[model samples]
Target: MLCALIGSACAGARDEGGTDEADGQGDEFGGSQECEPDPRGTEPEVALPSPHEQLYELELDTWGISNAGGDPVETRTRMNEALAWALDNGFEGVRIPAGTYRVGEKTSDIYTAGIELPGSMDLILDPGATLEMAPNDTWNYCVVAVRGLEDVRIAGGRIVGDRDEHSYGGADDEGHGVCVEGASKRVLIEDIELTKLTGDGVLIVGQSEAGSCEDITIRNSELHENRRQGVSIVGGIRVLIEGNEIHHIHGTAPQFGVDIESLSFTSKDIMIRDNSFHDNQAGDFVNTDGTNVWFQGNTLDQGDVTDQVDGPIVFWKRTDQTIRDNVVIMHSPTVNGLWGVIGYTNDDEPRANPVPNYIEDNVFEGGGIHLARNHGNAVIRANQIDGWMILGSRLSCLRLSDNAVNKAEGESYKFREVQGVASGNLLNGAPVALPMSDDAPFTNSPPHLW
Candidate 1:
């Protein structure tokens, strides 16, 4: 009867209630009735892992390098030789002990780099180790230069540039602290202190025709008081810059903390997050013109100091970009004729068409956000602005929603021939009702009156 009901033949006889008599005896219809113990009743023993790579110490004193600072010409020569030896002998890591090392001119006409890190090397510096640069006019100036390398890691050091010692002769003659350029890949630079450079603190450039240097990471670093940008990326891909402190950058015209652009190609897939930017000389704390870039959780403050910064962020011809969860306080009196918390513009023809830009959940104080002649689809939502907001003359398809704008001196929202929707926004604690309709407007004409 049980086999007929279950549509299968039973291995043993069934009881009166249609239960298998051999149910607990490894029968086909049943299993053993005994309970099993849990395997995770006790914690498993674990072992401490070994270091990822072997460490090789380079004794500067053994190479006739002194801790007492002097002319670094000889030291630079020995340092490069040691680096070559390490690379040739297949060393994975090298450590420089704590000391002050001065680097100056290597030859009469050429200034040598303090250290040049090659491919597949981990260079570690002791906590008190310092590399000080002396003044020179050479264009090949850098404290650490990594060129045409792959899989390099530079961690824990102090690089002080010769800003006081060197004279700047335009942009070409300036020196950088750390430069990674020319076909470099998988470089990790972290936990370094860079200050008082004649040019920029760090520069990642791609000048090669083969391809732009890819997969670079810069984190937990401090760059301050540099002549130009704190960190400048000319051309690179998949770069991650996070948890950095950059400030007091005042040398060139656009003295930005991070400047991302390209001279030959397009820079893409870059992420800048959780950085602290304050007291920078220019208003554009972060200036980017790259595609698919993300800037989040960054804090930009122009302290009570007058004429410190002009704006928090500026983007040009960027696409698929996002700026969210950032607190930007632009309280300084406008300097260098630039003022705004956020600035967007597109002037280059064959323009990439800065579209689909999302600026949300950001807090802006003192100054407002501005859009200048942009012809893309943008969404400005859920922002708390303590100043005025301006839309340029040629903007199209903009959606502004749920934003609170406290009027500062002038108008709360200024529209200059913009075509967009203003819905659920608050201007001085009242709902804003602009004359927006479901109709396509003509070119160079106002969407509706404010």
Candidate 2:
């Protein structure tokens, strides 16, 4: 059932179930907002020490790239030549000057046949340069790939995909701007612009069981206007995505700012902090099945966009997530109604798992909590909500405490056939009894709009 939303998104990914910023754009868009420092009392363990300082700090033509004018054959030859040079005499770093290098050609392979990233080096492009993937009719193609490598960093410049010129004859929807695949570790991608992709702007997908990713960090980037997701995590661990602005992810299913869904392997210890997310088609964030994922201090806004399919956030019951200190502004709800966050991606039957989730210290303006059914053990505490609180129907061991919801005078907390402890909560300046009956606030008509 999870594959319905992500099956096509994971075209080259061997995981059958499929997968699963920039600075702030515009003035005062909060796209450049950073996270609260050391919430866990420590910095992330990112291994990005560039030790190859004395080796290869040269320019574009030094690596046999004389002319870069988006010619597929010539650019591919130059790229292969550069790659061969890097392979022969140890790659340290290379800089591409201000130019447009179009990669990929018709003679390349169908799946993932593009410019591959060399391990243990730095590929720094000039701020005015761009690496554009040449238009092809393939389902799977990566403009820049970091496959099964370590100690790599890609910074500066822009990497554009082939969404506009793709012929769509491959009959699949995976043409990423940059693909970080295989068992790669210690990779860092920062201060870059990734946009106009047929699939995700960037995809961190594991090809098989022996090729998952770890210790990955993507920060200070701008990813937008992708057909699928801004970023898709098919398989990864210890991934931190911070301080990016992601928006307007339309034209596909499950089009979140980030979709973390691992099928065969485990993807744990992920953090998405201090990002500005808005105008996404499906939602801002959705964890189909990720472990120990934290969404901290980000701004998720569903502004005047009325065609939102999913809400701002959707997480399955199997995830061990901690969502705290984020600001959710919801002007319009999705097909799942007005609750800004949901327990499932769709309005279907919920999955009942025993994982622990903490939803603490968040501010929801015109939005509310919707952790209905026996999803998990949720601790919903200390939030200022301006909308409904629909946590009902056999939710076990729930803790609803110290939350202030805007309700009518003499109104009570509406929970139907639920098992929970509700204390220190206020609805319309009154502390109505939540456990007074099976459906204490509303006995028959339990507040359900979807």
> For candidate 2, what is the total of clashing residue pairs?
7
Error of 1 at 283 (Å): 3.0
* Candidate with maximal TM-score: 2
Report the lDDT of model 1 for residue 328: 82
Each candidate structure's count of clashing pairs: 2, 7
lDDT of 2 by residue, 270-371 (tens): 889999998898789988788778899999998667967767887776676888899999887566666676775232234444555778899888767766
Question: Per-residue CA lDDT of candidate 1, range 1-450, in tens?
Answer: 101211111121111122212222211211112212111111111111122286579877677776666668877777777877877887787888888888766454545467777557887888888888866766547898888877788889898888877754545334788888886888888899989887788888886575677778888999999877788777877788889999888866457788776657557778888999887876434444567677888998876547653456766545456787888887654532223444444232322343456778888887667654454456778988876553433344566789888874655665543456668888878897765422342223223331
Report lDDT (Cα) of residue 262, candidate 2.
82
What lDDT is reached at residue 293 by model 1?
75
Global lDDT of each model? 0.65, 0.70
Give me the runs in candidate 1 sitting further than 4 Å from their true place.
Answer: 1-52, 106-111, 171-173, 284-288, 308-310, 318-320, 335-339, 342-354, 435-438, 442-450
TM-score of each: 0.81, 0.84
User: Which pairs in model 1 have colliding backbones?
Assistant: 283-310, 283-311
CA-only RMSD, every prediction: 22.5, 10.0
- Identify the leading candidate in terms of lDDT: 2
Native-referenced Cα lDDT, model 1: 0.65
